[model samples]
Target: MTLPDPGKSYAQKRDALEHYFDRTAADAWRALTSDEKVSKIRATVRAGRDDMRAAILATLGDDLSGAQLLDAGCGTGALAVAAAERGAAVTAIDVSPTMIEIARERTAMAVPAGATAGPGEIAFSAGDMSAAPDGPFTHVVAMDSLIHYELPDIIEALSAWAPRVTGSIVFTIAPGTPMLMAMHAVGGLFPRGDRAPAIAPVPPARLLKAIAATPALKDFTPGRTLRVSRGFYKSQLMELVKR
Candidate 1:
């Protein structure tokens, strides 16, 4: 993994990802077939998303009666849609236009009638996670999006945005582990089998140290960590709390 170009605007980097997914593979889950091997892989990926979504929701708890939520890097809008259903006014952002389109459709279908009259409205936009609409959000979530860059950039982005959130910032990463590293490498060898981008995991120790050193998180504390496995690999969900 490499740092984003220092001269490229955040939006520019985001656009590159958008174009990548759009031109490469837009719906990875749809590529799975009914073959026994494919079926298992599909199930695992689906379960992983479900598990991660649950973790994010659990971190937010049931206190979102009228909370403001930001779903940064909100691919497919699964979590954003769920949050809106649970009474959070959500602003979901993603780099891909294809993803934003699907997210808009999904959110429109999931949002309950009259829900928009309250604080649980849902909105979708195309932009970098770093460009998430300004908010003193009750909660912020970025799932499976940090693997695109190296550790330093991830930490800097997290630190810059931490102060804007009032509640916890929950994110998930493909942590660097021998098993997962191998999985990522092998997956790239079979791009047809994996529709998403092939991103390497970050070294967990280095990531943890950087998080600890972030100025914005100085007063905050790391929260729960969950191990979730799926599709021949495992991922870690970590939460950082300001209070």
Candidate 2:
């Protein structure tokens, strides 16, 4: 897997990622809107985010009360709203402007009036994780947003943000198992008018090794690995905590 070129400006990277999502915007909207049109696998993949978010909150336990939380690469604010409902002051960031817009709408509807997180306390913005508001958060949650990202890039981002988090970092990622790879290869054989955004899977062992090598995570310990089944494929939900 290739790392994003260090020489490229953050704007350039953001533009490229945006372009990709823009191309697949219709697919995303359809998946979100019409369940009848979505395949079983697609539905499972989408549901995995909600499951991951709940698991992250559960891991946070009583510590979630009044905790500062960062929901990086937040898509549509579901997880952020959930965190806020659990009493976290959350900052949710996404790369796509369209996504940010939808996230804001969702947050408004889902977050109850007089919630623990006051008005604007659970803010959603459009930008990469690097541009997410500075934080000394008690917990950080990134759901399945990294599926399209490479392992090296993921490790770098996690390492860079690790110092800002005091409690735990929990996320779910697509594992590069032979079965999963084969499924991708088979899916590629079919033709479509608009191609779906690429979902790159990472080898679980390699990802763990890379995370361990990162200086910022040297003292963090891996917690339980939950198996999230996506019909034909599977993902892993992992928790890393510093104590």
Candidate 3:
């Protein structure tokens, strides 16, 4: 079995994720995000994700009129659809072409009857989080997408994106607990086929310290936080806002 490669760069991890989600686990992911029945473990995961989504959206409050938002790493576009319903123009993107197509279909079915469609519309595409349109973006929401990268890489990404965002950037991370570290180790022993990319569990203090030291994020500050821990589903939801 291949051991954990600490030297794996961000691009390599991203390519792995693109392959896993777009090809290997595409069907499993689609099922998990749907209302259809799932296993007990995936059910907990779905619930935890739902809680995180609500927490992130709540931080922005309701009535997002005139907001230019980027739903970076949008999966099936659930949050994107919700934001659009609240009158925000959302640029929703993800690395998986299959997920993008699913998001587009979901959005098409989500149109409310006789509603004004121009201002709050959603543009869905297949690309990385960095593919976000030229901004002054009022808001950027990156849900569970960043959980696969190391703290340093995460810091670099936040630094690059912070200057362009006028309002806030919200995202999630897997906490670096001993149990998760064990899980990471055990994941390495699995056969190469049909295995998900390793999850990078990060400690909060370490992450926060790095964020504080990043030059580009100097103009921003950490905001409200929510931690959701359910069976087989653990995540830390965090917000970063302009100071």
lDDT (CA) for every model shown? 0.69, 0.66, 0.78
> Whose lDDT is higher: candidate 1's or candidate 3's?
3
Residue-by-residue lDDT tens digits, candidate 2, 137-198: 87778777666566766777788678888888887778755456456445431234444334
Model 3 alpha-carbon drift over 4 Å, by segment: 1-4, 109-118, 181-193
Query: What would the per-residue lDDT of candidate 3 be over residues 115-158, giving only the tens digit for each residue?
Result: 32345787777777865666778898988898888888788778
Off by over 4 Å in 2: 1-14, 30-37, 109-120, 178-191
- Residue-level lDDT of model 1, residues 126-194, one tens digit each, is 777886666888788888887666666678678767878998888887775545655654554225554
Order of candidates by TM-score, top first? 3, 1, 2
List the candidates' TM-scores in order. Answer: 0.82, 0.79, 0.89
Which residue window of length 10 is worst by lDDT in model 2?
188-197
Candidate 1 runs further than 4 Å off: 1-15, 29-38, 109-118, 185-195
On lDDT, the leading prediction is 3
RMSD of 3: 4.0
Show how many residue pairs clash in every candidate, following the order shown: 0, 0, 0
